[model samples]
Target: MNEQHILEQRTPQAGRLLIGLYPARYRDLHSEDIAATFAEATEGLNGRALLREHLDLASHALRLRLRIASTDPAGRMLAGTAPVALALAAGECLSGLLPSLTALATTSPQARPRLFAVEVVLVALVFIPWIVALLLTATGRWRRARPVAVLAALIDLGVALVVLGAYDRAPGALLRACALAALVLLAPPDLVDTGRRGRWEAVAVALATGVPLAVLMDSRVTLLGWSWYEVPAMVGFWALLVVSLLLLVHLSARRPDRLRALGIALGPAPWLLEYGIGATHWVVAYFVVLIGGAVAVGGVVHLVRRMLGAEPA
Candidate 1:
């Protein structure tokens, strides 16, 4: 490490790109220091070591920008929500699995073994790894869980490429797989600590996930005649509707844990996103009403607080 060499490596292009991922204000103040430190730390690294460093940097950058950093109460709320959200996404997948599999079986018989196998592989890639990650996280083994989830995500990407090459379309499961993997990996490891409370959260998430799975699988519970997929969306919409209404109450009441409650309310974000991606007319309306209603209520509350001299000048 001569001075010239150090200088050149001190602000490597790759490091600068990563530092750019930070918020604009933060990057302006700290990008030079951050890039210099990263370059120095990674000078001799290459191959998997270099890739790992890049992934870690990118993951942390995302966590900070997303408010899931694990240092603040709000971040802690998201960290706690991560595993539960993953479970809920997996449950959504499971809710539709039988119908999907049955359809594949009927359609692929004797003529499309390759396509059928690819689909099954896609399902396994998304579902099994997520379940394993959930189990690992639930049992307080985040160190193991993170790597497992990441590897699964990589495989999903690779399979997605192959599927696209062969069929000109990627599997739909890829989106959910990546979303859950990001949730598992970007979550601050320290925020989801091991202990009774951690175990209880995992346990509750698992049991709640099972309820949707059972109901969707039964086919007898179609009160609204909603499809298997729509059932979960309906369930999630109502759940969020209730949470948003409760959030309005908490906002008025000035509850201290309101931020945490908001985080919990957002736990269904992964499921909601999947639904929104290909939602039908009614489904889109459900989303709009919930989101619009929440925003309107929050605005009203803010105006009331301002009028009452309850808010700061």
Candidate 2:
């Protein structure tokens, strides 16, 4: 095909989508060069190459998007302070379960701290920001972005419910009733960006979700005997609790900016309370493991500070 013919076939929108992955600075200066390269490289490429190109494009785009999003005003406001809240919440809730590698791998006792440290960092970086954003928006910060957050929170809830059902049948070692509350509060609500009053809706959802999630955990103690698995039921229990809290926040949130600020701001209170309770248990029942766990937390904190380029938190 002639160069002119091929250029005529390409849409500007499609070109933009493909080029969106490059850094803004780079794109601003060299977009045509990059596009020309991609177009020439992709022309007559084999199927595998085409797939590879698609993925490469997507990966670069996502990298740029995240880099840009982290600095965007709204995104910063949502994540700047909230990730810490969600991280503490998940860490507090899952402290006991993280080290139990009773699955296929035979975990050495000496390696537990390192393993737990890795788990904490993964959970903090990958999961916390989006989850907290969902909660803040669904509960109160209704915007064009709210629907996406709400959908994700729902998926989080759905996964928890699935685990809850499994607990009903086979039983497992799992968290207590409070995990339901944690899951609920951590989620946003079901409403789209419809400017609906969400705080009360969230509250009702919380109460409703809480009762069943609690039942699931309690029954697991009876049905499945809450075995080694309870240590890792972190996800299900957290879902119920986060969703419930989101319900309440949806009903009560007065303003979006305030709500966004509050979502991150308020998460630590419950986390601190839970942490104190868990610490007491660790001291009394699992003193050595608890000490190791504390050490692990310190190590992980060091890692987070290093990775995020902040002082030792």
Candidate No. with top lDDT = 1
In terms of lDDT, model 2 sits at 0.42
lDDT of 2 at 22: 73
Query: Compared with the true structure, what per-residue lDDT tens digits does model 2 show for residues 1-313?
Result: 3654455355244555778767788677866666676676677876555654554455345545555233344343333223333333333323322323232145453668787666555445434434454356445553322333323334435544555566542122123223323333223222122244433343333334334444444323443556334543333334334533442343233322433433433333333233334344532333234323433554565566668987433
| lDDT accuracy of residue 278 in candidate 2 | 39
Q: Cα lDDT for residue 147, model 1?
A: 66
RMSD of 1: 7.5
Q: Which ranges in model 2 have alpha carbons more than 4 Å from their true place?
A: 1-16, 21-25, 46-48, 68-225, 228-313
Best by TM-score: 1
